[model samples]
Target: MVRVATLLLLRHGRTTANADGGLAGRQPVELDETGRAQATAVGERLRSVPLAAVVTSPLIRCRQTLDLALPQAEPVVAEGLIECGYGSWEGQPLKKLAKEPLWPVVQQHPSAAVFPEGESMAAMSARAVAAVRAWDARITAEHGPEAVWLACSHGDVIKAIVADALGVHLDLFQRIVVDPASVTAIRYTPLRPFLVRLNDTGGDLSGLVPPPRKRRRRAARTTDSDAAVGGGAGAAR
Candidate 1:
């Protein structure tokens, strides 16, 4: 297996619902004008960097962000890298749903929350880890001893990926508050993953190195499929 040079994970740019404070899980919203600009800025800042591949979730917002952020490099859509399905909450307002007496219970026991008949955090976390692991494996195989990767995903999914990789408890999900367009860097040795940076969207890549050469790859398209996987063998999808 080959080793990766660096892995940069980016949350998608802002969306209409993001501006509206909507839950947006499985919402399939695209970037508004402002969001496009944000993505454009991110791409400009990262324009000089090289990425062997740009992996993204299959959501419209994620694809749009990658389109804007990696203007030159095309993205490859990976189902494992997609956002957590909110299930019954896909298009509903959480403010109203929280009215359920079990809302607190659901928050506390996300694994059993059921999202009012939807998926659970345990399930969401499983597939996300699988996706990252799959990507990590490919990074080793294709990029040689030193390859770089960029994943454009969602807040909940990325957090789950982080928590799982760092061995954090699944129940305490709020340990990290990932903002839109924030860039987080985590390094994985062949054995364990080492989080090199977190929430570094403020333009700090201090210990990070960009691609050694300016390169380009074919872009991947975005989709709005609403199906989801269980994410792993340990949890129910």
Candidate 2:
């Protein structure tokens, strides 16, 4: 039997940063009202699953998200699983950053790039990779089989986690779209990793992420705001 390593990635609930075009990375913000609902919904979705371990970022947002998702769940704090740090751009609006071409590069080469006053993409990738490998090793030694490693983290860190699991580059980040309170699952074998699922609402939990309710008008200026993380780069600094 292939050694299975299942990683359940959870994006935190919403906040003023997500809706207001601000960078909430490492700001210690809790789940907002809507964020609480989103978190609660996620909790309900994951309520019954037998989770081996819960890994989480230290940031309040992600911690809070995990708190709601796993009311009775206990998590290990992994600073490596923390969100990206945008440096000077921590609180800047994505619309404004769009003016700079480097913004696009950072988004595209996240595994190797970063904004000024922040950690580099390579560093992000390494830290995430280390954390995941550590989790896998510990779980393998602790649980004989049928154990799943569940991690509650921000979007970028989860993306990097996916990329590392698949042994790919940052470009893969484009293919993965994790929304707030969304869950992505990966089933891993001792030999390799396979994508069991991708960015999903409660629907993706069972491969039934419902279609969009309606054609929502999008902000022309913020095409990749949440998708493009402004924080969650380095360890808490």
Candidate 3:
């Protein structure tokens, strides 16, 4: 069987910094009350899916979100999935950061933006992409090609990963908005990776569920990795 895996990228629940319009960076920010509620809601959405592995960034916000969302699952903490080291920019208000010289660079050309005393946006993208792809390969190998896994991470990191998967440039990653607790799905095949979903916050995950085995067999004639012309019929209702 061809090896394939579905990766669910979940942005951690909201934090005080999110609500206050400040950058939390690598700080150990706890989820706010609303953030906790968001986690619970996403948990309910994911409760039906059988996941092969659950991974999370080392940040406290991510850990807390996963604890609430998938209480029964053990999550592996990945340093590569951690939030970008915002360095001196950590905890700074977005409004203030917007006025800084580097702010425009980060907005227009993130690939060239580097955090003072921290990491560069390009480096963050490279590591985050590598981490999730590695985890996906490992999960698919261990759990079979049908494996589905999740990785909980920070907003910018998730956005950057999505940008890479979509073949968009790191400079345009700012255009992608990954809301707190939103889930994006990507299915990887030998040929290419399909963006099955993007920034889904409504909690409707029915489409991710595999079809009945018999139906899946029939569908297998055409590779699921191939984008359906005319948008296809979408996931079977």
Q: Give all TM-scores, in the order shown.
A: 0.81, 0.80, 0.94
What tens-digit string does per-residue lDDT give for candidate 1 at 20-119? 7677888778888888888887776676456777888898999889877886778888888777766676665678767777578656766665555667
Candidates sorted by lDDT, best first? 3, 1, 2
User: Which pairs of residues collide in model 1?
Assistant: 74-218, 74-219, 127-231, 230-237
What tens digits encode model 2's per-residue C-alpha lDDT throughout 122-159? 77767876887778678756864456667888887888
- 10 residues in a row with least lDDT, candidate 3: 210-219
Please state the error at residue 231 of candidate 2 in Å. Answer: 38
| Collision pairs in model 2 | 83-232, 84-231, 84-232, 84-233, 85-231, 85-232, 85-233, 203-209
- Model 3, 134-166: lDDT tens digits are 889899889877778999998899899888888
lDDT of each: 0.72, 0.72, 0.88
C-alpha-based local distance difference test score of model 3: 0.88
Write down the worst ten-residue block by lDDT for model 1: 220-229
Which candidate wins on lDDT?
3
Q: Candidate 2: minimum summed lDDT over ten consecutive residues — where?
A: 206-215
